[model samples]
Target chain A: MTAAPAAVEARDLSKEFDGRTVVDRITFAVPRGTTFGLLGANGAGKTTTILMLLGLLRPDRGEAQVLGHDMERDRFRALQRANFSSPYVSLPHRLTARQNLTVYGRLYGVSEVRRRIEDIARELRIEDLLDRPVGKMSAGQKTRVGIGKVLLNDPEVLFLDEPTASLSPESAAWLRSFLGAYRDRTRATIVLASHNMPEVEAMCDSVAFLQQGRLLEQGAPRDLIRRHGKQTLEEVFLEVAEGDTGRQQGPGDLA
Target chain B: MKASLGRIGAMMTRYMYLYQVSPIRILELVYWPTFNMLIWGFMQEYLRSATHPAVFAASYLIAAVLLWDVLFRSQLGLTLGFVEEMWARNLGHLAVSPLRPLEFVGALIATSLIRTLVAVGGAGFLATLFFGFNALELGFGLALFFLNLVIMGWGVGLAVCAILLRYGLAAEALAWGALFVLQPLCGVFYPVSVLPDWLEPVARALPATHVFEGMRTVVQDGRLDIDLLAQAFLLNIPYALAGLAAFLGAYAVARRRGLLMGTGE
Candidate 1:
């Protein structure tokens, strides 16, 4: 019998803008129900890579597939079972969280949308903020609402670009725990892109460090630390950034 | 692929929710159309006494102004739906959803229909009250004129959205100014024959020109010009289809360029 397909796969994916390569021929596969991190500094092509996987951006070469559907041609099929969220993107400011949630729920074709919104609001601990306009909410509240939006459909594959990039530490920690619990409960495959090493180490099953639009290295956090003789993923990130030895490391073991 | 009406309705519902919160937004929709109607109505009254009264009927100017608002308001409504998504920075979220680009365009068109009716309906009611000129009296001619103008408006509105998608927020001024550039060419206030010899061909090529010319025939000749109405619709087939193609092309380019990821004002 054939092995089960990876929940997410990128085969030699690449992109460029204005003569500058943003994501060079990178390849990876994320197993079902696992949390994978794309750790990178700013301008390291983390967001661009996620966008291509979400089919919000087209790769200049190669393929991105989610749930065995080609992202470029069959994205709608994957999108039906997927959702994306980022603090950098926003909901309508004039709309209350409930209103915003209801709209997206309907867009995703959720049954009993009002009930789903209440359930998500309760899960995200956003019940009190439901009637408040998104613009009136603090950053933490908005991030919760954003997460609530993602969870509305109970997506099988979730793409999050810097999920807690702008939150305070306390809020970030709370969100990390919330997501960890969410993954445990739903068994959803999550692709998280962030530069925060601790967050990546805490939440990810495996991670790949990207530098200057290229994949520097990818492995289990602890294994990467052990392999590079480093104490933390942060130190490993620095070493990988300075060295050019990861061109051979691929997602072979993960796939 | 088959489009989902439920998704389209959901997008429309989002805009309707916006109106529910902002009374100012609702009021702005009707304010301009009504204001234009009243001003032109009073001017027609003045022209009745000052100029050759028999040269143009009393209802001619009032009807022209009312009909013209349908096109302007409809185009504004469609573009406003798009611009609102940009301002909210919600396009990125929308792009990743199960929503298709054409389905989103369908929502914009449907929302514009609702908006155009509210604005032009309110203004037309006022036209009947203030000028004692009932637009409804034009009968089937009114439907013909309304249909052709709205189609042309949607055609132009879609092209504007294409430009906005490709060029970013800097080109937003086209939303308001694009249709106005067509007004003088469409002969909203005068006959296309009154245009200079070199410009008449350009005027005649526009779908709105046939619509306004058709309106003038109803008002001045006291008869609906079926031939002109047919010509307007035939012209709209290409104009509207071209706009749809342009919008889809721009959406593809935006996807390739990753513009949809961060499009905002």
Candidate 2:
């Protein structure tokens, strides 16, 4: 049988700043409708790689395609079908959550923007906080609003950077469940970059670990744990990150 | 282009929402212009009485104040718009969206135009009430002069934003200070001829110099100097183009350096 096409594909993607490499040559492919996790510690270049995939940061070498569009040459075309969210980035603080949603909705060219905002707000259980200024909302509330903003366009590909960083355990659990359900319902692809090991293990169908800008290993969470002979993904993560280089698989060897 | 409009309008809506929520923001926009108009009105009255026979003294000063605000407000509008995104840490969010850099800059220009109109409108009203001078009395020339000054403001504002983009907050002072540096050089309140012989050519190089000189012609000669207007518009094209290039260049550097996410506190 023929293989399904990739929702995201990168080949030898690399970046450097001030003579220090931030993202080394990393190759990976995320098949359509799958959840792929990018796991890395601080300065491991998770955010840089995500930015490159989104075409917000140009890679110094190699290339990427998202939703089958070349990220470098046709990013706008790809961007229309994708959306991103991060706790580090925020909506205008002074605008009410509803206003923020409306503005982003309009920018994404969504029809019936108000209705879409309402639907997403309802789905995310943030309807009550919709009228509150984003600055006044709690971190958890802001996280939910950020997710709602990403969902406004019903994107085919979702790029998330530390999406649950500031959420409470309950909210984080709820988000993971919601993302799983959303993925199943729409068969959409998700590229998650997170430091949350448990969250990655639970939500990601496949995971890639990065160490100092290099792809240390990649595979299903279970496969990685088994290969590293670890009890959990976090232990495997620690093993890879701390330079306990074992028989780890390379890029595109996830299967 | 249609997408550009949607993105641009969305950006403008973001600022409009800020203005709507904060009465202080709206008040701030009107306050300075109104205050300047009031102060200038009294000064103009003194000049008219002291000069005794000069019919255009009050009109000239009021026109200068009104036109100067147009330039100032337009520039501030664009710079502050960018600063707001930085302050909110929203640059990364917008960067990943379908909004192109050109569209983002276009939105800043559109937002600046709106801000310029509101501020200049308030000041012009104050000028009319306090000094009995209608800057609009300059007729169609007023529109041409306003366009020239605003375009020049965009040029300067874009360049300042570029500097800030590349250098971060340490360079933010340029947003406010850069324009003032040009104020003396542009002869906003005085004739370019007043400058030393060595500096006259430097003053003449600024589009605002020709704009202000054109304004003086309208006020004193009671007729538009098509040549001066043409020179102002011509000079503005290069300034505006340079501003655009500078901004695009800075944006490229910021992207490559991954500086967009943390530009503001």
Candidate 3:
């Protein structure tokens, strides 16, 4: 039987700075065509791990493989098939949304780039603001533009760092539902790092619990909740977050 | 090999087009050459009183100021490019991309070459229109302008970029200051004869000084000196090579040190 492709697989990954272990020997594997949520409070090395996986950071020891490409040897080829998005890194402020997308699409050597730009812009619902400078857009508008820019090349592997980070509750819900639709259509492997536990419970097929750069547990969110005997994922998140998994609570608690 | 060359060609074309069309980049393109030539024009007027009687007055400073920019602004481009990446947070993305620092530097060099042409072209135009200094009329000086300027300018830029990459925002302002330091030492605005006797040896040691003096010699009197050209080749080859070496060394160090992460905050 042919083995299933691993979207991201890391072994003995480590990164240290000035004698401090930031991500200490962490390893995990994410299967393709599913969303893997990495959960931890801040400073848990969530971002660091993502950076290493994306080939943005190098590990001091061990092997990392992303999209079947050895992290060190063929990262560029791997990165060509992948794209990452984050709210923190702003797209070029001077360029209009359309201009920014075209520039990156060309850099990525995307075929039919003009068509791809218009299509991603339409999907992200920023067609109206396509000509507006990115700096002039609202936070929500900029977020959509950032998403559109990342989507312009139609990457096979997508990583979202706080995908719906700063949006209205209603808007975030619409965004989540839109992502659900996009996933159904593309089967794109999404590895999202987020603290929105409901988003995780609502969207993820599997969730990996991370604490202090260590994977504490991995299972379906629903199955983990059922096993923990919690009424809601939030209480489960609290229980896991507090290291108090035996507690009982209702779904209303997190809401 | 051919396919990779195609990819590099495509990237080079796309970015060169992007930077060329960018208003900010265009401004960077036009402003320095315009300003430096203006400054040189005024200085030439002042020094016209006591220049080489055999040669014309504008010859010394105009060519010197213009030559200095090739070195100074090219160095400045690398620093500003680093700053722009830091601002855009695109530096990390590029680093993570299959591009090595050399490829990244290659694109910047390409951009610098384009900018240098615009600057030199603009400077030459102004000198002709405003001061009647047609390099084509001078013959061969135009070719050396491209050769001496682009090559040595790129070397200076690489060195500056090396320092900027290793240090955080602290030395960025040095980009503007470098020309100020290099020019006086190179006698770009004045003849090396005007300096103290000891400084003549220092001026001879710098290739830029030779290029500037050679242009003055050629442009003013329609004469070329093989000795000055020889001196320029000898001095520039080592500095340019050393600067490029320093730049690559800094790139390796920055990659290891996480300065390339753009986390100066």
User: Tens-digit lDDT track for model 1 on B1-265?
Assistant: 3338989999999999998878789889998898899999999988888888887455788989988999998888999899999889899999899999989999999999999999999999998888898899899999989999999999999999999999989999999999989889999999999999999999999998998888888887889989999999999999999999999999999999999978997
Q: What residue runs in model 1 are displaced by over 4 Å at the alpha carbon?
A: A245-255, B1-3
Q: Write the per-residue lDDT of candidate 2 for residues A47-89, one digit (tens) a residue.
A: 8999999999999999999988999899999999999998878
lDDT of 3: 0.73
Ten-residue stretch with the least lDDT total in model 3 chain B = B2-11
Interface RMSD of each: 1.1, 1.0, 2.9
Q: How do the predictions measure up, each by TM-score?
A: 0.96, 0.96, 0.87
Question: Model 2, residue A122: what's the lDDT?
Answer: 83
Quick one: RMSD of model 1?
Answer: 3.9
Clashing pairs in 2: none
Q: After the best TM-score superposition of candidate 1, give how far the Cα of residue A179 lies from its true spot, in angstroms.
A: 1.5
Between candidates 1 and 3, which one is better according to DockQ? Answer: 1
Q: Pick the candidate with the highest lDDT.
A: 1
Better of 1 and 2 by TM-score: 1
Per-residue error at B24 for model 1, in Å? 1.1
lDDT, candidate 1, A1-255, per-residue tens: 987789999999999999899999999999988999999889999999999999999999989999999999899889989999898887889999999999999999999999999988887778999999999998778888999999988999989988997788988898899888888888899999999998999999999989888988899999999998989999999998866534344456335
* Model 2 chain A weakest 10-residue run by lDDT: A244-253
Question: Which order, best to worst by TM-score?
Answer: 1, 2, 3
